[model samples]
Target: MPAPASAPAPAPPSPHPLRTRPFRLLFAGRTLSLLGDAAIPAALALAVQEATGSTAALALVLACSMVPKLLLLPLGGVMGDRFDARTIALAMDLVRCVTQLVVGVQLLGGTPSLAVIASVEVIGGAAGAFATPTAAPLVRGTVPEAGLQRANAAMAVAHSASRVGGPALAGALIFTVGPGWAFVLDAASFAVSAALLCAVRIARVERPAPGARPSVLTDLREGWREVRTRDWYWSSLIGHSAWNGAAAVLMTLGPGIAVHRLGGGAAWVALLQTGAIGLLLGSLVADRVSPRRPVLTANIGLATYALPLLLLAAGAPAVVVIGAYGLAQAGLGFLTPVWETAVQRAVPEHALARVTSYDWLLSFAAMPLGYALAPLAASTWGPGVPLTVAALVVAACCLGSALLPGVRRFTGGPDPVAPAGAEAVSLPGTR
Candidate 1:
């Protein structure tokens, strides 16, 4: 028989970032951070609702937290780029730890004034503004470029796992003891996170040349330019903004729904738990599938972001609502890694934080508005009607983006290569 053609050499295995010490430390710290974060909202919501019997008051408290973060996010991004991101993250956590500890102590004494709680939330929100922007840049710093998708997926797993435990545990604590203990737990979690980060260090970032340094205004201007000039990027932001707004409404109204409409805290926790499980599964899918056309896959999946809201609007049974929310979260999970990988790869490393800040600022722009509107609408039309409206809004924005010029065409990050005649893929990690 004729000599068989030599088999093609096997492709080299890609780097696994979690194996590296720095990345492991970063991951552990961030995992702890997310646990605290996930606990805060549910605990805060219950505490505020109990202290003040009005949904509007609850909305105001949450809005106070969100508005500052929204306004300060761009500045936070600038800080992330200019300073040591790790240092900034650590400092922010310490600030959050102290503030939360104080708030929890007060709550332990008695139901504090609504004003006092809101003020504390404001401080926590400010710290969050700086902390949130640092996360992406910090991840980029710790993990290898080739393993960005895996790192992100791993963090998503951490996030989902934390959410699964945090909210339910917080709810149970609120039921048994009080919201105070939940807050204390979160404070402890932040302190732990800070300790982990302090021990793990990275090389100092080089300073920009004196001539090359841009004013904050110039950095903001440049970041905006990058976003607005890109059809896909801007459209994606707009789409996500709508979904965010819808989610804001849910955050404002969901607790009330669980407490009064559905059953109580346990039901709320179940809803969150189901969604968390779906998010976990979907993130695993992202790590495995790295969809061939990431933009297309992400945007297409995003249209489902509002499905749970729609189900809730219909006054579905608890199981039905939870199931829909889980499905929606999974769809959202599919988009998260792809979009993040795209941004990390496409944006210049030097400007990544600023660009990320702009993205966050824009994404959060509509949230406060939705939050402000939710209570008012709930008072007038009830939560279901407004939730239904929010769902439609999400659909309009996301589906509309998919129809945009470049929303489905622009796929960034590590582009995947395929054999001749095979369709293009997003990355090699994807199946």
Candidate 2:
């Protein structure tokens, strides 16, 4: 009797994602873009005030920027899947660069007209709608599967740091050189980001068989089908949307509570600063752990957010509220990178952007609605009522999602029953 052949050895782990050239380029480009993104809110607000000086005008400009992104995200997702994600992202960077340049030059010349500001914002918003969905695919193309979580954690750290520093940078520029200069610097960041992206080399994805592609509507349907069939993914989206809505409620009410019940604006500022620190630390920690059930773990982590809301509803001391808020933000920080890594690992590469766009759309859709309704609810029933309700909704949705079989069984490897027609692209230097 012949001995059975020994099983083949497993492949050795790849080097850290940051050590790879492609990932480095992608990371640099994305970090620059994120910093610019962080600066935009403050710069835009100042520009609107200096030019139009109306709160309504400010709101309108923000709406102009936001609504288009929400409406066009699905379209962007399709484009990302159909075309080269790197190219699409690079093009959008250039488009946004030009838009910011236009705004900067106008502000430099003196008060630009409201029409000019609004129009540029519209263009930027539309471009962002298309660009946002490409990110997951880009990361998938750059980093190997083994290092995905680390890559995401590094990106989250950049985001956390930017949240702390970007606004301060904007304020410094705005006060010393003027808001025009801030916009110009932001434009320059985009230009630099575009250059970095241009240097990034990704493997060429094979196009689908000729006429294998379907109409735009059909593509949309396919993306929807992909999302609907995944029980874990859709359930997580529900929990995430509830989390966003509840956070909005907190934001709307927290300020008033801090002012009237706590000390004042300083207390709110302390809370924000503490939360930012917690997020930074959480990002650091997320890189260290490997959860067996990624979706369930992330959702349970997200449930920590309910603690702060409950504390606020109970009229806890300012120190207590602030500590809970920081802990909550830390939970979010841990959840985000893990969730993103899980999605990247499990979802098919071909439809990644399209599926993620649905994730983005639904996760964000509730925020504005929450912002609008929270105040109304509070006015009618008092702040405590809405706060308490928001807390319960967040806790319920997160914990309930965790209990689902699909979510529990998800180990953040490839999907066991991935749909037909899913394609995996080959990349160099990692896998």
Candidate 3:
């Protein structure tokens, strides 16, 4: 009977080191950090609007915040890949703390000049560019490959929780103590996060072998090469770029549609955000159930985003609109962890920051364009028309990415056991 090949040695158990204390601390720090981050935008927006009474000025402030991220993200990624992520993250947090403290002080005194506010935002954004790419690699380094999905999922939950809670808190604070106090709160959160991170001990890995210290340009070139060679990477990137681009347009126009055409206002916006929060919850649950094949699942979740947008275009009521939005958010939440896990599994730890930065740069490149074009397009064709187009674009991107051969067939992580007739390529920088 040939002993039935002994079931291929049971594929060895996944090495997910979930019980590690440092990982738990790291996760707590991320949760607190993101919670503070989520509060900043809303608080800042309210502060600017109250001070300037100009939506255009508020928009400019937001733009300043985002523009640096788009410009400096790749460089930030390089930094993460080259240095200790723990150190980078701690330093960035400190920078953010100082920026927030300045804003809080100014707000408490009086409305500061727009230039000062914009400068602070720009600095914060630049700091964020350095912080984000480090986050994934730090998590990867803390846990085994088997735990990547769970770790990513835990981070996502923190992000979602922040997204869910931050605005509500900001709104409350803005109404009660005023925007400056909210900024103060954000500063405190960053302080807490920095302290937590300081307490967690991380074992540093040696730098890549001596000759492997490629120049920055060379490293960028290699990172680009790695991405281009992977069908899954390119396909997903293209899809998300299209999806986010269209979503940006929808975000700018949705308010007008709800207020003018649908006769809803702040209530509708709240509903939309609430839906996204619900989706985050659903995603957290999905991650706990299974860690395998996150790419395919993410693709599926992304496709679901189109549905709510389409329903909104079709003139759904506030409840239906909110429900659809929630569903999309949930789907996006599920997609996030899968994508993060895939990146960790495929990219070398040494090069992870660079690759992640590249990914963010390309993925977000279209956001500013979308935000800029939405108003112009709405003026010409009316708001509903542009929103409908955005919905269609999102649907098309999701479906198109799913059709990519590599994306469809991808399973999560590397093989735990050696496969027949395959030479194992050691992870990048490993001897």
Candidate 4:
């Protein structure tokens, strides 16, 4: 008998994802783009206050930017699914570049009216709706399955760093030059991002031939089907929305508690900075963490948010609140990359963007509601009551989601069972 064949040599370990030129371009472009995007809140708030002065006017301008983005997200999902996602993303970058450039030039020339500012912001925000959902597909297209977690974690780190750096950058520019220059820099950032995108070569996802293409309504139906069919997906989304709503309450109340009970503005600033740092650390660690049930583990991590809320409700010392808040933010940071990678792996490439849009829409819609309701709840029952309630809600929702049958066992691939005759959708090696 022939000697038993020796086991084949193991395949060489894949190179670090960043070592790949395409992912490197993608990583750099998104980081720079997010840095610019992060600068917006601070710079825009100041610019609006100077231009309009009234808090109500400022709120209206901000709402104008947000509401359209939310309203058009479904359509954005369809566009991402229907077209070449990279091209759509690139075009949106150009559109935003033009819009931001126009806004910046106008601001520099003189204070544009609230109407003018709001109008331009609507255009920019609408572009963002289309742009946002394309991200997962782009990552999946550009990186190997083995690298997905690392790629996402790397991006998450960039995001957390940008959240810190962007505000500081904006503040410096606003003080030295003007807020107008910040927007100009943002526009320049988008232009650079677009150029980088022009160089990226994403794997083509096969689309239906033109003659057989589905209608937008059909696409929407299919996307919904994809979501509703996955008990894990829809259930997790509901839990995530609850988490968002509860977090909003904490955000709405934390500053006041910090300033009045803990210390002063410095206390709140320190807490924010600590949270940002925790986010950076958590993102760094996410790539190394592999759990048997990733979705369940991530939700368990998310439930930690309750600790900070409970601390705040008790009027804990600044140091205590700072520690709790940092821990909670770290949980959030870990959840971000792990959750993104899980969804990318589980969902079919054809409908990934659409599914993600639903993820964005529901989770985001809850936030404004939470913000609006938190004050009312506090006014009626006191801040402690709301904060305590938020803590319970967050913990319950996240833990409940984690316990859901589908999520508890999910291993980042298609459901093992499929409808009769339909092929199960899955990424190789994911299961």
Best by lDDT: 2
Q: Which pairs of residues collide in model 4? A: none
Residue 123 accuracy (lDDT) in model 4: 96
User: Could you give me the TM-score of model 1 versus the true structure?
Assistant: 0.83
Quality of model 4 by C-alpha lDDT: 0.86
lDDT of 2: 0.87
The candidate that achieves the highest TM-score relative to the unseen native structure: 4
> Please, what is the TM-score per model?
0.83, 0.95, 0.89, 0.95
User: What would the per-residue lDDT of candidate 4 be over residues 327-392, giving only the tens digit for each residue?
Assistant: 988988998999899888777787888989999999889989989999999999889998998889
Error of 2 at 290 (Å): 1.2
- Over the stretch 1-431, how does candidate 1's per-residue lDDT look in tens digits? 99999999998977776887887898888887788777777778777777887888987887788888988998888888777788999999899998889879878988567988889889988998999888777777776567888888888778878867877787788889988988898888889889888876554445477688879887777667766766777888888888888988987898888888778888888887788889888888888777756776787788786888887777778888888888888887878877887777666555567778877887788877887899999899888888989989889888888787566666565323321222221222221
> What lDDT does model 3 reach?
0.77
Residue 354, candidate 4: Cα error in Å is 0.6
Candidate 1 clashing pairs, residues 3+ apart or interchain: none
Give the higher-TM-score candidate: 2 or 4. 4
Candidate 3 — worst ten consecutive residues by lDDT sum? Answer: 415-424
lDDT of each: 0.79, 0.87, 0.77, 0.86
Query: Candidate 3, residues 1-431: lDDT per residue as tens digits?
Result: 45554545557765444477778888887787777777777788878887799999998898888899998998898789778888999999888999999999989998567888899999999998999888877887777666777888887877887887888888888888888988888888888888888877665555666577778787677667667766777778877887788778867777777786566697567766776577578668756766455676777678777776677777877777777788888887887877888888776666678878887887788788888888998799776676777777777777777677677777765534322322333433322
